[model samples]
Target: MSAAHDLPTTARPLSPEQRAADLRAMTEGELDVLVIGGGVVGTGAALDAVTRGLRVGLLEARDWAAGTSSGSSKLVHGGLRYLEQLDFGLVREALRERSLILHHLCPHLARPVPFLYPLTHRVWERFYVGSGIALYDTLGGRKGVPGHRHLSRRQALREFPGLRADTLVGAIQYHDGQVDDARHTMFLARTAVHHGALAASSARVTGFLTEAGRVVGARVHDLETGEDLEVRARHVVNAAGVWTDEIQDMAGGRGSFGVRASKGVHVLVPRERIQSSTGLISKTATSVLFLIPWGRHWVIGTTDTDWSLDLAHPAASRADLDYLLEQANRLLAHPLTHDDVVGVYAGLRPLLAGESDATSKLSREHAVVSPVPGLTIVAGGKYTTYRVMARDAVDAAVAELPDAVPSSCTEKVRLVGADGYEADWNRRHRLAAEHGLHVARVEDLLHRHGSLVHEVLALLRADPDLARPLAHAPDHLRAEVVQAVRAEGALHLDDVLARRTRISITVPDRGVEAAEEVAELVAPVLGWDQVRAAREVRAYRERVAAERASQAEPDDSRADAARLVAADLRTGA
Candidate 1:
């Protein structure tokens, strides 16, 4: 798949043994830098460091973005809420990055989305909001995103007819960008690898490798092969996000600073239930609930609260579910219930803990520290500013390197799909027509894969059999599954379902009936025998069943126990 786009090819099949050998070789060469964590920030750091002419390697315990990165609300915004707290520096920085991404980098992965912020009062409220939005526009250079437009009550009703007349006196419409967080993150990893950053997932970092009382590298476990690898480097940077403390403990440090995990949950409901083209941003008594347009579904969320649980897989409690429903229903014409919730996701935000009791007050400002001489830890930045965080992390590590590594140039390094996306996007119609695929379908692929759409289309062209849709989830084209395994580092069915395509939670059956077909598609690349293929498919189905069952459980303890069954099933596979 990657060959069509001229993307540098990874080995046809990525095996743990091959990965370990590569890591050991890089370490023996005494790498310039090694980044711990495979989330967006970590991957970004790898890209930044490598592009700056440093020999780099990245290690992740699970698949890319399996942690806090994939669990976000998926908005590329300047944290509008932070504006309320007078976080001018953060808002300005995030806004600049948001523009950089939408207008320059990853345009295909991130696109403009319109949202209406309803105003309950007229004169005073309008002036207050209008002024704030005006400042917001100035901060980002706005590009061409329409400046906030005021809408009268009747006009607002026409635009958002489903909203109760009592809810708003008017509205302010503005634009922000949204992204497929997991897909974009995967692309970052691939881009980093393309730029010569050694990237590996399903490889667990067992502990830090120290020399003379300083961390020099890490001892990683190849979960797939049950072997250990010692990767040595001059600088070890931690961009672990929420798992920052865990890595710090392995290195015998204080984590440089405290990190707090705040849980935010989102629910998916059918889009037809909401009668509006524009998304809605409403104020909750405490936080905010957004009813965003998510293709065929409306993503309504989220409840931000403190969480102390199995940080790996946070179970959304019964209370958490009810709280979200109660808040979101207040705006719906017909309130959503458990049945309307076809999918649910919970994400943890790794905020820098502050004096305030509230998580909302926690600083989104990121700090880079050489907690130990050889280790540079970066944490606490928003998604929009990931590139900036990465650049800073690489800069910190450069100071520790034995030889001076040139400054990061990733600010100009567009991701793999960014080049010529617009021109190719314009040609999508002609190409889709020639291929006998719907134009809308072509646009979807272009947006998701960007200029790399040709790579996926080539798979369909090579094998007409690959052009069909996934058996259960017709929304996803079959070629996409093959592409996921071949080029996108989807080594397992869970990787394909959960992050690569998000079919697991996006659909009601959690993609059970589609599992076998997906497994069949990936089997050729993964070299799985029939027994292993069947086991992969079955494990995915049980994972879905367990998640569905856990959601129905009355409380967190039951939900936690039930969720464990799913993990146990996957392990048994």
Candidate 2:
């Protein structure tokens, strides 16, 4: 076994042994900041704080990005619609972050993706929409991506062959960044660990540890081992996203601001279903619809409606699916039905509640407040500006410390696997030759693991069978599953299929056929026997079944009830 000191700081693996060590460290020392939640904002806050030379500990109730972070539309662009809402500052901030993500932060994980906005009305609409995109380009600095392009009806049809000729008089194409949200969040947590911060997933913060009405730390419950630990810190940051209110209540007060949950659902269809080279974006009655081009699939989505159901499992009802299909069909020459959808996912947005009853009108602006003397609550921001949210949250926490701390410098800190990504991509063919794998396969691994592809290559060197692709999920190698457990902090089969590899959403069976194979592959690394492995597979299948049943329901209440039938394995329901 390699010693902790022997590994490169950027390459430190979040293996099971590392998790145990982190948990022990959390209990042993009083950290400078203790972060609650492991979503993008929370993990980003942990990374920001640790890099500022402060001792930090991050805790997540479930798997990393298991909630809202994993369920995003997977775009990292300035909200073009928000510009219509007259939010210029937010748009400018997000566009700057988008540029940083594509160029500096996680170049391997995020890249520029083009989207075409179909204009139905002839001259007026074209000028209006085209002007907004031009302004968007100006604010974005036109740095890492191309500026907007105006296409006539003939040109638009040529670019997107699947579009209906009658629906679009013209189109405007703009560029935005896209990423694997789950893997990006996991990388944030691991990057914090690399900077000497302690982080443990499946560790729920049950209550706040208070000292004479000032928040000090938290009472954490480890779902994996069923152990309760008291982690002490000088200050605590509640970056819980939609769960912000719940954490604030534990801190013993209603926070200064309120967070309302808005349900957004996305559906995945085969790439061939829409013969578009670029993505599609259109205006909806409530919000907007996006048809994003994911690998081998087109991700169409998003219905913005208020949700008051189960916060953990936001269900996508039949109405939600129909609404999305109805919107997408308005533009597509070939209408898509329910049969065309291979996968569906739902996520909740933590919108800052305003006077408007419609969640769509709620503000995406974030607020950072110290509810108590030492507890800081950061909530209500979009995914594109997570780094700014993290920086502001850490700034608030650092204010309460006795000594003066440095300002946020995360803009300069590249995430683990970001360094040397370009050089690795240039030499991907050589790597494939060395590993006796296809160059295409090596390229895929480079995108997912960046310069860290060498670590996965070592696995193939030791056990060549691991290089074989999974029978059901041919896009992913068996070695990827092993790496998910041994390197990425994946404790459950769902973590590997659903988050680490995305086999759950890409495959037709939603990873049901791959569950047993993935379970057996990671069992030894996780110290699970045959019975435990079988139990994990059974739990994953039940979860998939419940999700399917929920999608068939008519409304949110019924869908929530259907989804509740599958108990969470970590919590045992």
Candidate 3:
């Protein structure tokens, strides 16, 4: 994964001085766009605008994808549920983007998965469900991934024997893509950086640098270092999905559309506990629930409802959990329960425009506007169609720029890990033998890190101890933790656990017991002293404990308070 020296992969904290230097070089020597927020959409926008030959700088209030981006159902599907709502335009756009990621842009990161839609009613239900899935398949996205297949009861049972025999008469198994949402967002930011974009996490936009009623740039606080730095640009793009209005206000006023926060909660369980080869998608009375396959865990979620809780930490309430378990358990042969839950994660979706009465009916379509001079805000849109949103955001920003801007080149851009991934995968056995690890273990690392596995492998070569798996969570190698701290800009233990590796949610006890071990692993790379490391571990545990306690609460208000009580161990805190 070595590249030009401009994009260094070093074991050092990102500095405001370095960013300021880069910012100066960007604005004085070259300039086009400055994007705020580090979610998938913002990262995508940065990559898009920069590759279009614009000098770009992207800043995030927290880590990339720390907000809604990390808290997805982890599926890159075209929203099959949207089809029933007659949102053909939305579904088609997403399906097309899903194809681009699967077949081209990030083939390694986004891979197809099969999901069985079990039919409860006999003849009518089968036909109704079959037609919907048929359209889902034939809409013929930018196509390399497979199509949907109809299954008889016998065939469906063969595919997933865990379903209750009496519950479903037949099924339709359809294909969709999935990804590590947080990692993908991080990669997006990294790819943007690789292309000469100055991207920084934990850089919050406190106020707009305005003069004569126009946003010139932003006044940002480097949360980790405790310094305020001004980053100026000719045009500013606010791709802040959830906090679009907040940024708009900072830019001097609010926009025509308002972004409402909707909470989506997901629970994690051991993979084998599901007893299904294919994932499951079921209809709920109000919404839908998807059973997704994570690496070692099965992600069953997600409960969607409007949430006005603390934006940072959205806790899944007991009622929400009850609703999901009740819905999913309707057809399962073995019912899931509280004890089966290893982790609970809730993400807030920025349902923009606030135009719909029903949360499920709310649009995922994004809108871009220059609510004020020199500022562009792009909000809404599903995760699947982020590139489109990015492209749109850049187009609007281009209008504000006084000079000609190059056409976007990100459609052809591959993230660091995408290139040479299949070849490395084909040589998995050799990699395993060479590294003295099991072929399965090597394959896991290969898929997760792609060609960048060599980066961690290089670390292990430097220190053999890095090759040993973590004491608490044996699934992830200790080297990966160190690599995250060194190369991935993991500012804290919670960042490493919650988003970087997902060990916090995948493991039981929310990685409480693993916190100290992880703190020890990342300390040397991050230059953490005994006090810093211990404080990190303690903070992470307290956060997890607070989330756990919050889930036991009855409603969002109590849950929000409890989750906030943990005091956010993030770099911003």
Candidate 4:
């Protein structure tokens, strides 16, 4: 068969043993490409390269989506605000990507979400906002999702009873895509692995392997086992996101491009706090606020400001919370307070620097540069456009290869869980009944795992106790905790609580109450001893406490200090 016809198969389960094997494989021979950083772009780049039949390896210092990818507004849309800035091309590109994800690539993980844009002015505001929304709908085309619709104040209030009467004269409702960013990124890596890419998380790159003033591969430190390995590759692609500069320094000096970190914070409030049928979007003084619908909660966020502090933990200050609460209160009939916020999270965006002083004004358009003969660096793009960034980075890397490489076929590639999802969903009731579970529980698993949900179901069959819910957080099944370590690459308790499942951010105690129980459940799978399991539980508690303290701080510096109180468990703090 021609390499061009290579298609992804059902992803092999991302177990710890598989991760160790991947690291060993990278050291044995020279790979065509070595991807550094495991964010959306990094994993996406790995997927893009492997689909082209290139031998590829992916490395991450932390777990997948531990960086900016997981901490997003969770909306995949054409930049509605960008339309006002006249960045029509960017908007159109994002809309097309949004449509692709909604209908083709990851329909199981990504779904249509409606947002209401309230208009304050009677005449001009409606005409102006409606036109932009109409353009947004037009750009998205007719098939994937619904179009925009205009509503009067009365009709709008009927649709969204949470809106304050004085907030707007009318509203425009539109559709966009939403996803579980962390799981989606993990799935992307699994898809790459399925198509023959070596993938490992918690493997930190210590330095670049260089010869005769050219790049070769990297020296990596395995965090889990405390072992070091050398990885050799003809071409190295850096999709390190905000840490692009650090990776460049390891390579020698600053590559032709620069990235600036911008902090964005979000708070999760209980669903009943907002009596709305659809999500809410409105302009803030600096950027915008989105009230997105999470399962049993509403995520309201985002303050975009320049961040120069710690990249790993972007602290959400009291002022950040106040700003969001104040803005959200303006639109809500019932004001939300600090007591109402169940969880808070902050993430940093890597924007292309030197364009403008304001981080918000910086371009999200990614750049791929070949600073050295064997190294390629790609940075600065939104999560919605990661595939394009990945494609471009691979193209640049392939240009340096001595031989011709196949073109990117990732656009046609449906992620591992996407294939046969519709059929699986149609049989969800039958599957649920056979498994002795509710249909809604199966639906949740289907959305999280798609057609591969059968794998999770097999675990329940092997052990019936896996069917029980977590004592503290009932939304997730106990089997998921075991699956996180056994199947997905969840090494630490934090990985299971924070990313693999959203227990850390969904529950009011931030998974502290469930940490001990969940840790015990996963300990056997991960081979954690009693002492190690206790330490993991303690680390998670410290993390939650630090985040709480950080959120209480009045300013960024203070917040950063508070958050730093809990050093990363992976780093042995």
Find the candidate with the highest lDDT and give its number: 2
Residue-wise lDDT of candidate 1 within 110-144, one digit each (tens)?
A: 98888888898879999998788878888878784
Predicted model with the maximum TM-score:
2
Candidate 2 lDDT over residue span 1-573, tens digit each: 222112332478888888889999999979999999999999999999999999999999988999999999999999999888889999999999999999999999999999999998989998999999999999999999999999999999998999999998899999999999999999999899888889899999999888899988899998999999999999999999899989988988888899999999999999999998999899888879999999899999899999998999999999999999999998999999999999999999999989999999999999999978989999999999999999999999999898999999999999999999999999988988888889999889988988877777777767778889999999998888888888889999999999999988899999999999899888888889999999999999999999999999999999999999997899999
Q: What is the number of residue pairs that collide in model 2?
A: 0
lDDT-superior candidate, 1 or 4: 4
lDDT score for residue 413 of model 2: 98
- Stretches of candidate 3 exceeding 4 Å from the true structure: 1-30, 570-573
TM-score of each: 0.95, 0.98, 0.95, 0.97
**Deviation of model 3 at 471, angstroms:** 0.6
**Whole-model lDDT per candidate:** 0.82, 0.92, 0.82, 0.89
List ranges where model 4 is wrong by over 4 Å.
1-10
TM-score of 3: 0.95
* Model 4 pairs whose backbones collide: none
Q: In model 3, what are the clashing residue pairs, if there are any?
A: none
Model 1 scores worst on lDDT over the 10 consecutive residues at 4-13
Worst 10 residues of 4 by lDDT: 1-10
Clashes in each model (backbone N, CA, C under 3 Å)? 0, 0, 0, 0
